[model samples]
Target chain A: MLSHQLMAGLGLSILWINALLIAGAALRELAALRARRARLAGPLLRGRVEQGLGPDRAFATHTVEQVGRAADVRSGIAIHFSDRAYRSTIHGGTLALADGSRHTVPPSDDARSEVWIAPTEADAPPGDAALERAWSEAKQSRGFARSLDRSIREQATIAVALPREEGEATWVFDERFARDWLARREGLAALFIVLELAALAGATAVCFVGGSFESVVTKVGGALCVAWFLGVQPIGVALSEACRPLHRAPVRGAWRRP
Target chain B: MSAGTATHNAESRIFKHPAEMRQFGLVLTYLALLFAMVFVPATRTLPCLALACALSFLNTVVIHNHLHQGMFRSHSLNLAWRCVLSFGALYPASANIPSHNLVHHHFEDEGQPDWAAPERVGFKWHLLNLLHFPNVAGPHTFNGVTRWAALYGREDFRRQYTREMVFAFGLTGALLLVDFWATLFFVLIPQLYGARCILRINLIQHDGCDTTSDYNHSRNFVGRLFNWVMCNNGYHTIHHNRAGLHWSDLAKEHEREVLPRIDPSLDEPSMALYLLRTFVLRFTRPVARAVALAEQRASVPASDLASRAERRQSIEAELRAAP
Candidate 1:
C-alpha cells in the first residue's frame, strides 16, 4: 500500500510537471509572437509618421478607411503617434451612418475609440445641435486621447483603451507586463526545471545522511515545486531591481535619461 | 559622471560567461550515485526505490545551487549539469528549472506566485486534489468503498491518472505473482511510513519558525559531516542568500561570513531541537509576532523568513526609541 501510494504520487508528479512544461511553452510562444510583431511593424509606422503623414492622416488615408469600408461604416481615420516613449494612441475621423447626418467627430486617441453617427430626421429642429454634439464629442475624445498619449510617453506603462457604451471608454492595463517587462519570462519554466532537479538531489542527500523520509515527501509531493514557481519564483524575478533587456538594440542607443 | 561610472564599473565585472570545474565534478558524482540507488538493486528494489525517492528529494535542493552557479560559474559544466539533472524521471527537470530559476527566484512567495500555493489548497479540501480533481462548492461525501472506487476512476484526472494506474497495477501484479508477504511488509508499509515521515519533517522546518526572520523561519541543521552527506545543504541561510551558488562553496562562504557573526552561545542547541521547541511553543503562543519582531533585528535570507535587523529595529523603534 505504501509503495503503491508513493509510486502513485511519483506518477502524479510527472504529469503535473508536463502540464507546467506545456504552459511554459505557450508563454514563450506568445512572447515570441509579440516581439516579432513589434520588430516588424515598429519601423514601418515610424517611417510613415516621419514622412509627415501624421498618424491621424496616415490612418485616415491607409488603415481607418479600409476598416470603415470593411465594416460598412462611413470614413474613419487612425491617428498614429511617433513617440514610443508615449504610450497613448488617439484616433480621430468622421463617421457617416444610415441616417443622413455626417458626424464629423474627432474620435478618442484610443485604438478602440469609436464615433457613432445617428440619422437626423427631416422634421428635426433646425438648430446646430447635431453639429454641436459632434464637436463636443470630438473635443472629449481628443482630450482623452491626448491625456492617454501623454501618459504613455511619460512613463513605462502598458495600456489599451477602447470606446464602449455611451460616452464611456474601456481601458485595460497590460497586466501581462510580467511576460513583457522581464528578459527571462520565457526561461521561467526552464528555471523551475532546474530547481526541481536540485531539490530532488538535496532530498536524496538528506535521506542518505539522516534517514529523513520527510525530505522525500516534501521534495516529491510537488507542493514545493508548485510554491516556488507560483509564489517565490515569480516574486524574486519581479522584485529584483534589474532590467535585463531581452535583445541588444544598438540602433536604439541608450534610453533618454529621466 | 563618466569617471564615476568607470569607477563603479571597476568595482563590478559583469560576466560574459561563468563556469566552475570542481562543483561540476561534485554534481556529476552525486547524480551517478543517485542513478545507482535507483537501478543497482543490491538490497531489493523496494529499498532501492526508497533510496531513489530520498535522493530525488535532495536533488531538488541541489537544483537551487545548480541554477545560480554562484559558487561554481563554469558555464559549460553547469549547463551540462542542468541538462542532465533536469531530465530525471523522478522529477521533471524542465518544469522545475524554469519555475525555480525564472519564476520562483523572481517571485519568492509574493507577487506573481506561479509555483508555491495551489490554485486552491487546504487539507480539508485537498482529498479531492489527491485524485487530481479540484472541488467546486457543494456537499461532497466519501465512504471506504467509494474512496477505493474513486482511485480506479482515471478519467477525472488529467495528468497522473494513467501513470499512477499503470504503476499501481504493475506493482501489485508483480507482487501477487511473487511473495505476497514480502511485498506487503517491504513495499507497502515501510514506504507509507517513509512518506508520512517526510511530510512531518517538511512541516516542522517552517511551521513555527519566525516569519519575521526569513532565515530563522527556515532553520538549518548545520554540521560538516551531515552537510557533506547532503550536498552541503545544511547551510540554508547561505544557500538562500546566494541561490545560484553551488553546495560545496556554500559552506565555505557561510563560515567566512555568517558563522563569525552569530553568537557562539547559539551553537549549544541543535537546529532540530530549536525547530522542535518552536513547534511546541507555537501551540500555546503563536510565534508570528515574536518571529516578526526578531526578524526586525537582523537579516535572514529566505524571503519568507524575517531578518534580525528588521526585527530589532522595529522593536527598539516601537518599545524603546520613542522618547
Candidate 2:
C-alpha cells in the first residue's frame, strides 16, 4: 500500500497537471480566435449578387404578418428578427408595422425565404461599427465571444455594391455559412477535449501510483470529471444553442434592378 | 421585431414557464437534505450516504435543467439559486454555461471539434470512455467558461463563479479541517457520484447515434418515472430540437413535433432495461444478439429521415389545420 505522504504528493501532482492543461487549452483557443478574427477582418458583407433580379429598387414600409401559425414559424421567423427588424408578436395574429399599421398574413413557411418587410428605421447601417467592435472585443475575449461575434455578424445589415451585369444579389446568408461557422467553433472545442484527456491521464496515473483504488473521493471525482467532459458538456452546449434567442438583423438594400 | 418591441413583448414577462417553480422546490429540497446530512448526527450513517447520492443525482438534474432554463427571471435570484445549488453539485453553478451551453451544444458530436464528443474514443469500450472522459473534457469546460467570461464582459458571471468556487472549496477545506474522513464519505464522495451520474446519463442519451440527424441524432429513454424524476431529460430529441423549451413542455412537444418523424428505435421504454442489457448483460450471447439486432434496426437511411425543413412544414400544416 502507498504511504499517505506518497499519495498526497501524487494527488497534488495530478492537480498541477490539470491546472497546466487548462491554461494550455485556454491559450490555444485564444490563438484560434485571433486567427479567425483576422480572417473575417474584411467587409462585414461582401460579394456580388449572381442571379435572381427583381425590378423594385425603392424601400417600402410593410407590416409583418402571421404571428401565431406554428411554433416553428413563431420561433424561426417571428423571434429571429431583431427588435429593429419588425414589430412585437404579443398581439398574436396581428403584427404592428413600422408604419403603425397592422397586417395579418399566412404563417411563415420558410426561414430562408424573403418576406416583404420594412427596413429598420436607421439613418445608416451599423455593420461597420458592430463588426469593428466585435473584432476588437474578440481579440481580448474568449469562450462565448466567438459565438457572440458570429451573432453580431449575422445581425449586421451591410449594403454591398452590386455589379451592373448581376441582376439581384441577396446577401448570401445560407446553410453553408452556418455549417462553416459551426465547424470552426468545433475546432476550438477539440482543444478543450485534448486538455481534458491530459487531466484524466494525470489523475489515472496518480490513482495507479497511490495504489488506493478504493479512495472514494479520488475514484468518484475522476469518474465524474471524465463522464462530464466526454458527454454532458456537449449535450448542455447543444441545448443552450438551441434555446438561444435569435437576433437576426433586417436585410435591406438587396440592389434590385430599377 | 424592434429591440424595444421584442423586449416589451418577450423580455418584460416576469414568469415564462411553470417548471421554474418546480425546479426551485427541488433546489430547496436538496438544500434541506444537505443541511441535514451536515448537522444532524443521526443522518451521518452509511444509509445517509445512499440518500445523499440520490439527492445529489436530483440536484445535478435540477442544476442541469436550471442551467438550460434559469430558475428565475431575476438575474440576482438566479445567481443566488446557483450559489445554493453549488454545495450539492460540488462545482460552481456557472460551470456549465460556457462549456456545456455554448461550446458543446453548438458543436454536438462533430468528431474532434465537439468538446464532449463521445465518439472521440471508441464507444464500444464503455468503461474506458467513462473512466477517461473527465480528464479529457474537464479542462476544456473550465477554459471555455473562463474565456467566455473574459470575452463577453460578463464580470458579474466571473465574480459569481469565483464566489461559488470559494464557497465550494472553502467549505470542503473547512470540513476537512474539522473531520477529513466524514467530509470525504458524506460530502465529497456523494457529490462526485452525483456528478458522475449526470455525465453517465449523457452517454446513455447520445452514444451510438448520428449527431447530425434531426430525429435519430439522439437516443431517448421514454421511461415515464425516470423522466419525471429527471425533469423529462429522457425526451432528448425534443430537447435538442427546442433547447430553450421548458422541461414541462417537452412531452407535448415530442408528441406533436417529434413522434411522427422520429424513428421508433430511438425511443427506449426503460433506461434501466437498456443499461442492464447493453452494459451488464452484453456478455451473454442472447443479450448481445438482441443489442446488435436493435442497433441494426435503428440504422435507417439518412434520406429516409425528414429534413428539418420538412418537419417545420408539417408542424406549420398541422397548426394551420388546427382550429
Best by the DockQ measure? 2
Each prediction's number of clashing residue pairs: 118, 27
- Cα lDDT tens digits, model 1, B1-323, are 69977754543343222223333444454445443433333434555556645554444445555444433334444344444544322222323333434333332221222233232112222222222211110001111112212221112221332343344445544653454333433343333333223223333333334433433434456766667655765665555445545566776876665454343322223555665455343444223334444434546543432343343334223322211
Q: How well is candidate 2 docked (DockQ)?
A: 0.02
Residues B50-140, candidate 2: write the lDDT tens digits. Answer: 7778878888888877777666677676677777778777888677665555455544311124556554333244554544455445444
lDDT of 1 at A85: 20
Per-candidate Cα lDDT values, in order, are 0.35, 0.50
Name the lDDT value of residue A240 in candidate 1: 22
- Cα lDDT for residue B200, model 1? 34
Clashes of 2: 27
lDDT of 1 by residue, A147-235 (tens): 21111121222223333346643232232443354335445534644554565445334323433333445333333333332343233
Q: Model 2: per-residue lDDT, tens digit, A1-258? A: 223344345444534544444344344444544543343343333322222212222111122221111101212111111111322211112223334554332222223222222223423313655544533433331200211111112222222211223442122223245335535555555655565556656555644544664566555555444444345445433323322212222221210111
State which docking tier applies to candidate 2.
incorrect
